[model samples]
Target: MLFYTVMKPLVQVALRVFFRQLEVRNPKRLQVPGPLLIVGNHPNTLMDPLVVAVNRRDPIAFLAKSTFFQNPILKAIMESGNSIPIYRRQDVETGAEKLTPEQLAAQNEAIFGRCYDYFDRRGTIMIFPEGTSVQERRLRPLKTGAARIALGAEARRNFQMGLQILPLGINYFDPQRFRSDAFLNPGPTIRVADYADLYRQDPEAAADALTEEIRQRLEVRLVITRDAAEDELSQQVERTFGSHLNPDDDPTTLYDNFQLSRTVQQGILYFEQHAPARLAEVREQLSAYLSELRQLGLTDEALESGRQRPGTRLSRAAKATLRLVLGFPVYLYGAINNYLPYKLPSMVARRATKDAEFVAPIMLVTGMLTFSLAYVLQTMLVHHFTQDWRWTTLYALSLAPTGFYALSYWNNLETRVHRLRALRLFRREPARTAGLLRQRGHILQLLGEARAAYLAARTAQRA
Candidate 1:
């Protein structure tokens, strides 16, 4: 408990720095807690637990794969963080498989006993029902461990304990990207006590039924598609049309984006069932429109207001030029002061690992350490050379704000460059630009029609 209290603030700060926006929907639902079991989908590996852990007031002990405990440093950290290790058949190392079936059964029994004890003490335990992390738009078949653990604990106490299972959906905009967005949506709580009667009759049957119910509830909150190809199309549609439907510039809250994605998925399904030819034509048009945007280095927002008038284009150019002129001095200062710390993490990650899921966490941890160390070294060198503590202190303090300004300046610079290129294309390649605009118009029309049809069908079904 002491360790959790001490580390909670630090973890929250790290997560805030790592993700640009982390919004937790219906956080109040998590307050009615006792011996709570949190079940969430795993898309990001270690990052998933970190997200869930920091959101609530209660300290959560997670169930982690046993292989993570093999490393001494990591095991120390995990133990300190109140994590429980669950051994899996796949985690048995070759030539190091020491535990036989009986021994493994004993280990699991001990683990479950510990879980029951923890519940008796009114602690929260979080488990990823999917058992493994995969970066995809669909949920995998849920394992029965979560349901089993909850039921076993309740049954052990004669169904008197108030144990509840909370289902959470972790939606990541780009899980492996630094400064990306994530949304934590909490579903309705399942009362373990309510299932006691069923468990009393048939344990296995009760576990299966509870698992399926949890799966159904979780599926509603996630953007699950049929396959990879459909998932890709749904994502593309969301990226293209999301801004129009959700005009909020803040990326911190992703509920709106998730709704837009769900709507797109529904539209895709409706088209496949009712209007295949129309769907095929629209898909081709969307593909071409996306290709043109890529070729011209443009975004959907650039054309959100439709084809720009000549005066509006000229006004935008003049405003952009003025911003460049005014901000150049600060940009230069920031770039000079914060170049190495900003670049080193990316370089290290590129050379370190090929796994996409591991890259973001690695970069975040490495970047935090690198920046802190570099600032300290730079401050000491300044003091050594000038023999002035005031200047060194000022330099150290200026590091963070300057780095933030540099990031903002770089993003603006990229946007300005893309806009400039787009303006040039608009002026010089009138024919091509016109054709692209026509394709955009067609795509929007199709989307509007499909959205209407989809909503109508959904309404009829509900009615």
Candidate 2:
């Protein structure tokens, strides 16, 4: 408890610094006081728990796979983070295959006993019902451990122990990328008391029912697709339409994109059921537009406003040029000062791991360590050369803000470059640019028409 108390603030700070935008929706849903079980999808391995843990006001104990505790260092870290390990049959490696069924039962029984005790004390526990992490839009089949644990604990206390199971949907916008966004959407709480009578009669049936309910609730909160292909198309459509809808690139744009994807999926399903041919035509148009965008090296934003008037184009170009000219000196200084610390994590992660899901956490932890060490070393060098503690302190303090400025400057520079390329294409190849613009306009028109038709069909069905 003491260890968790000490580390919570630091962990929260680290998470805030790691992700560019972390939004928690419906946080009030978690405010109910009682024995709580946080169940969520596992998309990123270690990072998933941390994201949830840091967001909540109360500390949450997590059930982690026992395999992670095999390493002494990891075991210590997990223990410090208030994690309980559960042995899984799939996690047994090599020699562990020889373990008898009795032994496995004994281990899990002990874990469950501990869980019941924790719940009795009105403590909060987090479990990934899916049991494993995978980067996918759809939720995998959830295991019954979470439900069983909650029900078991409540049963032990004659259903007097108020246990609430909160379903959360963790949505990552490019999970593996640095400075990506993550949204935590909390669903309504499932009260264990509501199912106490059923559990008393048949425990297994009650567990299954609760598990299915959790899955259904999570599915609603998540941006789940039918399959991988649909997921891919949804992402592409999101990127294109998002640029159109969210021109300023607000932080909430990611969540907005998620909602947009859900609507698109429904529209596609509507077409699949009633108008397959129309759906195919719409898909082809979308694919062709995306292909043309790729070929021209242009983002959807480039086509927004559809071949902007010459005056507007010139005005935007002038502003971008002015920003570049004015910000260059500060950007240069920041780049030079922060370059090594910034680049090392990405360089190392690219070489070290093949799994894309692991990359962001690796980069975040690695960057935290490397940047801190580098800053200290730079401070020491500055002190050594100038022989003034005050100058060294000033230099050390400037590292963070300047580094932040460099990151902002880099993003702005990239935007400017993209706009410049679009402007140049507009000037050099007017006919081709105009053709692409017309194609984009046609695709948007088709999508809008299809959406209207789908909505009309739904209205007619209801009528």
Worst lDDT 10-window in candidate 1: 89-98
The lDDT per prediction is 0.83, 0.82
Residue 197's lDDT within candidate 2 is 80
In the range 284-341, model 2's lDDT, one tens digit per residue, is 8888888977787767776563367889877877887898889888888888899999
TM-score of each: 0.94, 0.94
Residue range 2-108, candidate 1, lDDT tens digits: 44768778778878977888988888976657699999998888778888888888888889988888889988988888899887666664435557777777877
Q: What ranges in model 1 sit over 4 Å off?
A: 1-5, 93-95, 246-252, 303-306
In angstroms, give how far residue 457 of model 1 lies from its true place.
Answer: 1.4
The residue pairs found clashing in candidate 1 are none
